[model samples]
Target: MHQVHVVGLGVDHRDITPTASRLIDSAEVLAGGDRLLALFNDHPAVKILIKSPLKNVIDRINQEMQSHRKVVVLADGDPLFFGIGKRLIDAFGKDAVIIYPNVTTLQVAASKLKIPWHDIKSISLHGRKDIQPLLTALVGNNRVAVFTEPDFSPAKVADELIRRGADTFNMHVFEDLETETEKTRCFELKDAVKQTFSPLNFIILNRIKQAVISLSLGLDDDLYLHQRGLITKREIRVAGLSSLEIEPHHTLWDLGAGCGSVAIEASLLAYEGIVLAVEKAPERIQLIRQNISRMCAYGVEVIHGEMPECLESLPDPHRVFIGGGMGKDNSVLEAATERLRPGGKLVLHLVLMGSMARARDYLKDLKWPFSITQLQVSRSKDLAGDHRLEALNPVFIISAKKPALRL
Candidate 1:
């Protein structure tokens, strides 16, 4: 059987190489999206228009291949870079296909802007409902490039950035790249939010200004929007996170997340991981979202329902933090423990002795390795002409680890 040839068209028709031209000219059957196929309208090969329900297209390609026809698939840029080449390789193993590489849109965008793309984080917003990747990239990288889908435009991206208070970056929107009608424009997020562009566009975000909100592990309380006395103290948050022993890919849950302080900070530690902030109170849920944006705490999902019942729908956590949701009943604690993955860690913050006792007993029953830490934090206060240490409420942190599965 003849292997399928997947050719990348670079950024323009002129950019197609001699080798790729030879493959396209020799193909008995050609397959690609409408735009790519239009470039070769005069070609003699049978054209298969690639469209949604791509499974049909794959099946058709398979049928052609079985008939011993030479199939050529045209793709934009380097197909392996967020393009159809990977899907083809997955559909038919690597040995069954040959990919001809070319310059990607990211490379062209970088060249046009005269910026090095070596470190720029790239994500595609195509067919995506959540902008979590955008948010996450903005938090960690100085520059980000997005492959914009028709439905998820630059304006929508701007709106989300502005909403998250992560609008400190300058936006660059490239429309109809490499075509005769190609256009490039740059704007502040505020201005970008009000404008629209071609459906065929790419976005690059450059960090021009520092975020107004400070982002760090155990961020200052004043940086977050929360009701007075509702946020976790900075020191307690630090201690709790330390006890959770979060790894880069661990999924951590903040049960009864108040303004998402612990979860937001945990996101930094679990940078390549998932963090969920579960809050029951409507007002606090809003606050959690605001803090998530302000803090640039990407990947922290705000769950807006009560504990125990709400935790059921969530992915099992590798680390769990119980800050506020436990009532007189131990259902919340029980649920979190039951849902925790083996070798996972759970940490709880309590000011009340009764609550501490309940958590202690719960861990003891599970016979998990556990430890307690007493934290007494104080900040300096100006008394008259000088400063004095004003003590905050004492907090008890309980740390427990679920036993690993024995081999």
Candidate 2:
């Protein structure tokens, strides 16, 4: 059966395979975004439109398929590297499509760096507002590769990392991969921050022993200056952290930041991720700041404000911990329920049933998937030569996730 053919194109049209080029030039129906279309603008006898809203592209493919004309789908950088190829193939039968390949930006960057990609950590920051964490990852591993964005150029990334906390990694930027206009630079973040260049750039990051995860959150107490009675207890803090389902580079929010232990731990998860410590008390805010500093949680941000409000200003988080600011601030349960990314987790620690009821109700209203846990911890007390058990406090934790919404 004659069906649509999917093609992956490189920046230079000359890179197109002879068969792929012949298919594109002969395709009665051409489909792709402006960049891909303009890439072959001089080719005769075809129509094109800018891809937008994503759904439109899907519809266009469906439309061409009905007409039974040859349709060619074009993409760049492995299309599968955060590209549209997978979705298109998923919608149209894979057997009905043909994909031509080319060198991806990641491949070019690694080749120029003389580093094996398997040994490097990779991240794509296209259209993404953050790339700071990728810089931090360099401190633990060598040979990092990233697809960069315009505003968060290599310079901005270098500056933010060293400015925030990625001093240990060596950095490099590769421009116009695979072309004569290609260029590469290797230097420290401090030096890289001072320089600037073209938008067609990817980064290579390298780091040393700094990759060790700091599990000693206690020693960090001296570092952060937070408010009294506002922080999560180090003992109980593990519960919230565990429920977060955290990974390196996953964003987290400590809505009632308190002393910011959760946010600090979240930051420690990695620099590619964000940890927002939201609190209203100046004392706790100071403590949060100090904790972030002492703990070396460079990616953690301390915001002086209450939950829900402070949480609202940040991007949709991957995980959330409600350690303080419960009461009316339980509104975080509402806001979080709305902004919760698919599979994102929200965990709340409270001794009071009031907060638990609120969380339960909110999750029910949203029809989100959730689980609840109650923990009772006891302390050991000395009585003469005998030891007695004393209960510290019981905590109720509620964790919930919104179903993943996808194209």
Candidate 3:
């Protein structure tokens, strides 16, 4: 079988290893981007330009392989490090592909700063639409390296961090790595957002200071920026989240999310997952954003629309929490329950006895096993310079799980 050789050209062409050079020399087909291909413009071989809708490139490579052509695919840095090597490996099994790795941009960038990179968390925003990965990367790590794309530039990344109030890190942007024109500059996230960078660039974020509020399973209600004490109490929030049985990768929908306290904490629990906080009120939507920013809850998405309607465009959820928006009828509850994934859990916080009865009846009609926990919390308050236990409004926690599919 003719094997395809994927070579990483490092930062400079002069650094190419002798073995990679020999493979490129013996190639009957050369595949890479226009910039990389320009290095071997004089070489007499069939050229395949790697372009968008990469399936075509894969097909052409497969066709050339059938003809027993020696194919050399040129790439930058380490081919397996967020490059095209995986695609080739997927197209043709690992046995059919030989990889020659060179020094990566991250290595060079870290070397210039004299910083050890093994501890650094690296993520690529290249050709990616969601910044959740980047946000999640910032959760525990003090340092993060990012491979930026043209559309999602360094400035855009800084802008996003600033928007989310997770901009505690200093931004280090490296431009044109390994070239004489290479330039590296460090900026505070606020300043980085206003600056432009070269197309060929990467960024590093180093946490400068601890966030004002340390995130945990349950945060005090006073820490959040809710309107008129409209946020979920800490006790009920924890209990409701526990009832959802959230996993690290579970997608959660906080329907009728008021002030977004539950959704914010849920995002922290489901670190690798997404949380959609659907709220119809504009004021509460703003409050949710403020709380998300304050808490540095990176994965919670504030969706400003009514339940059942907004739920249509969202992906199927692994956990559903209905805190409000049940309306005068049970339409929202019915809609949320029906949309829960098989074996997924649904939790609701209802203060009204009438609403709780309606929910019970709905679950009964569907023959779904459900449980309810009446949560009553009390906190001590100062009464005339002395502390006294003050009772909070009682809440009914209802939880149910959809049955898994049976063969």
Candidate 4:
């Protein structure tokens, strides 16, 4: 049987290559969306309008191929990039289909922006309502392009971003790319929400101040609002987080999440993950929410209740951070360890030696693979006219990993 030709009709019908045009013209059967088929109304080929219930179209294409009839399928933009080309190839063997490539909408958007696209990230909200993946991608990326759908349009995206406290990005919207009625405009994320955009549009987000998010582990203690000096020290937070071994998609539990520094940092590291910060103090819960917004750490969810009790409703965690309450009641630790998914890691920070010893004994009793480190952090401070080091309180950090198989 002859191979079916799948042509990418760039942005406009005029953008179709001469070779592709000939393939379309000489085909005995043609299939594409209504709009695409309308573009070639003058063609004498038997046109099949592609629609929902994609299986019907597939069946028709298979029948045409079985009959040895020449068929051409029209696709918008480059078919390989989140397009129908791959689906067709997957259904029919690769050798049975010929793909003619063209400039994708992403490429056109980048070209108009006059920016390098090799380093940029691309996402399609075409049939997706979940923005979690997009939010995760926005964590450290400087440039991103999104293919918008009618339901999840640019304005919806802007609202989501604003809700996530991601005000550091500038939005550029491009509609009807490469056409006479095409429009492109840039706006601050705040203003983007107030504006209307066409459904046939894509969005490019450029970081306004790239330096806001950094790779460093310890953010300044002043960044969070805490009661007295109850927050986790910067050095200890850095030490504990380093040992937690956070992954991009891990669900983390931050017990006694005072000021939520650890959870916030974990949110950044586990951008695609969920971080539940269980803080009983009403004031602290408010502060954690504020800190999350300020840091643009949208992955964090503050639970305004005590740990162990609060953890009941949460999904199993891949990692757990016990920065508080473990010293007061080892039950929190026991609950966390019990609920931690197999092969997950748990890191605990304790300031008191008694609490440290109790935690060590509890971990040892469980016979889980664990280690303890004592951190003595000293910071340089200006005293008189000379710089002198001031020793902060020493803290103990305990880390344990759940075995893949229980004994």
Stretches of candidate 4 above 4 Å error?
1-6, 23-74, 84-98, 114-116, 209-215, 220-225, 271-282, 289-316, 327-339, 352-367, 379-391, 405-407
lDDT of 3 by residue, 1-407 (tens): 86889999988777988899889998899999988999999999999999988999999999999998888999989999989999999989999989999998889999989999999999998778878788888877889999998878989989888877786689999999888889999999889989978998988899887766787878888888877757779998999988998999998998888888898888888888888889999988888887776666767888898766878888889999988835888878888877889999989898989889988898989888899999999999989999999999899998998988898
Per-model TM-score on C-alpha atoms: 0.80, 0.71, 0.87, 0.76
lDDT of each: 0.87, 0.70, 0.87, 0.83
Candidate 1 per-residue C-alpha lDDT over 18-68 given as tens digits, one digit per residue, 9 for 90 to 100: 999999999999999999999889999999999878899999999999999
lDDT of model number 1? 0.87
What's the count of clashing pairs in each model shown?
0, 15, 0, 0
- Report how far residue 258 has shifted in candidate 1, in Å: 2.3
Backbone clashes in model 4: 0
Better of 1 and 4 by TM-score: 1
Decreasing TM-score order of the candidates: 3, 1, 4, 2
Clashing pairs in 1: none
Q: Residues 283-330, candidate 2, lDDT per residue (tens digit)?
A: 777666555444445667767876566666787788877777467654
Clashing pairs in 3: none
Error of 4 at 173 (Å): 2.2
**Positional deviation of residue 110's Cα in model 2 after best superposition, in angstroms:** 1.0
What's the true lDDT of residue 287 in model 1? 90
The TM-score measured for candidate 3 stands at 0.87
